[model samples]
Target: MTQLDTAPARLSPAEPSVAEPPAASAVARLTTASPLGRIVVEGDGSAITRLEIERAGALSTDGLPDAPDDLTRRAVDQLGEYFSGSRHDIDVPVRLTGTPFQRAIWEGLRAIPFGATRSYGELGRDTGRATAGRAVGGAVGANPVPLIVPCHRVLASDQRITGYSAGDGVPTKVWLLDHEGIAHR
Candidate 1:
């Protein structure tokens, strides 16, 4: 399998995170159809902040802007390429907002290679929190960018599908893992 893109640069605590950008900053959103479903991407004109997959639900603009900025457009294009099997990674800048440990776990998810997977325990260990499997699971579930961050690459210790928070949940994750040819029960 081709090497995947690593996680984008993380903002320091001192910097404004995506979840809480400057009050005057505009939040841009773009929704595009994909094989998985309708994917919604939101950014602050500079970097992506959130991505949501729609399945069995209506797409909502929620009064946000629809103009796709350079960064958001690039992210959507990369996602299209990935689903088409021409791209193995998405190399776009992302602004992640979360606790330090959650950010660490998200970074660890990015380290997992394409067509590969790591157990919750293994990922926790890799992130220097060997005894924090449950915490790691929470962090993974809270991942905002999902596929861009490769949160689907994590699994239970026995290689069983646990759960997914995006799209159709476990089925979505199963589809993603199968797309990458990662084995799961």
Candidate 2:
């Protein structure tokens, strides 16, 4: 990921800048330091939309717009607290975009509690879809908001740490669980 200390591209006064507040409805990006690495958070002014833990030096912004927003600032602060082990939960507003099934799975994930975990099948069963384990796993994998949504708390059927889409993958998942005081094999 690019260095957060570096200033982002700024518009000159002579140029006609978009009148919209930075990150209000349009995309805004911010990077905050973390125990694992630098994290890039993308959002619309209303809610946090995306989060990426930098693994390689590269940061991804495939189709995202650039701007500043208060939501991003809040998210960064919350994340900082989380990494420092002072915050157990994220209270920031988040915009989750996904299919109905995915959204349901995401909500289920949110309820898993701090320092606890549930298997995909267990999550599906708890959500009243006992036979949709694979589907539930798919939804968890497609989660748009990772840390805030708490997808890392979801484990494999055997309670093993499985795939993690952020940072260094499964290792990052283990680290997160460990930070929450949850033991993981």
Candidate 3:
């Protein structure tokens, strides 16, 4: 809701080179962060398809205009509040797709309260896969909804604020933590 730019992005080597990546049946809108995009996708007319994190190649690919829909508009507004420290939780329906194990990991990630975080090991334990921290990391990385699902709230077992992949890098993780008024312990 802060920064808005709808310019087309040049493809990068890291991006999928498929001539067609499938038409995005969704629309993406910008958030406060530069590489962040909040998208609302639908499958059945009121049912949401996916609320996802899109870095780049999103706006044009999703065929989005500068503005958002009523639901997307609300999402943008609430996210703005979250980033500005006026909000802590999001109340919206989101549909996600993943393997059963990955879904379990993501579910555990959702249980981590706001302004709080868990280590990979802790998440693995919570999910009843005590020694599956690496699996948890894989699921965390595969999370379709990052901020909405709060994957940024997950950290390494040592409690160090590193290894975050979203945004430019770990500084973005620090910012999210700082915004939530949580300090490293």
Candidate 4:
């Protein structure tokens, strides 16, 4: 998959340890979601800015003046195109500012492939950190971008699917897994 004209330089985190992101300016923002909640994706001049899932109508652009305005609409539009199978990859720029380990996990998640999946353990191996299955699970759960990162493609070792903080519940996760033909119960 190719990144778009606006692809960020480092979708991956910068260090091997967890650290806070330095304050930066954003260039755009927008949101999209299932019936359960709303997810707002923002971007800086060159990468994604925010990927927070919020309660329905939770966005109160009341006073947060720096909130992005450009990329959010792009994220929503592209996401809609994705669900419809008209687009195969997320081409918009994304920053995914987080810990280095989280960035590693996200990178692995990025390779989960369309209509495919991996167990936590499987992802651990693919990430070249076999001992980090639980850690990978933690990162997967913490994923701000789901369908984009395709976190629903990760499953448990028991061959059962679980844990999704976004959307209404596990049903969306299950439906997504099923849609991918992951063979789960």
| Top-lDDT structure, candidate number | 1
Model 1, 1-185: lDDT tens digits are 11112235322223223344536477777888897888998877666878999867655664455877887888889889999999887877777777777877877777777898889999788768899988999999999888888899999988999999989898889999999999899
lDDT of each: 0.79, 0.72, 0.57, 0.63
lDDT of 4 by residue, 6-125 (tens): 132223323333224435543455656643356667665455644655534564432354454555666677766766667656666554655656777777777667777778888788
Q: 1-185, model 2: which lDDT tens digit per residue?
A: 11011011111112111222334345779877788787888876666778888777556863455565887887888888888878777777666666556666776777777888889888788768999977887888877778887889888877777788778888888889888887777
Higher-lDDT candidate of 1 and 3: 1
For model 3, residues 1-185, the per-residue Cα lDDT tens digits are: 01111111111112111122225555434333322444343222222234444444343225544434565555556667776667776554444466667766666666667888888988788768999877888888877656666788887766687566665347667777777767763
- Candidate 3: the clashing residue pairs are none
Measured with C-alpha atoms, the lDDT of residue 98 in candidate 2 is 63
Best candidate according to TM-score: 1
Candidate 4 or 3, higher lDDT: 4
C-alpha root-mean-square deviation, each candidate? 5.9, 10.6, 10.9, 5.8
* TM-score list, all predictions: 0.85, 0.81, 0.69, 0.71
- Give every collision pair in model 2: 1-57
Any runs in candidate 4 off by more than 4 Å, and if so which? 1-27, 33-37, 53-70, 179-182
**How does candidate 4 fare on TM-score?**
0.71
Candidate 1 vs candidate 3, TM-score winner: 1
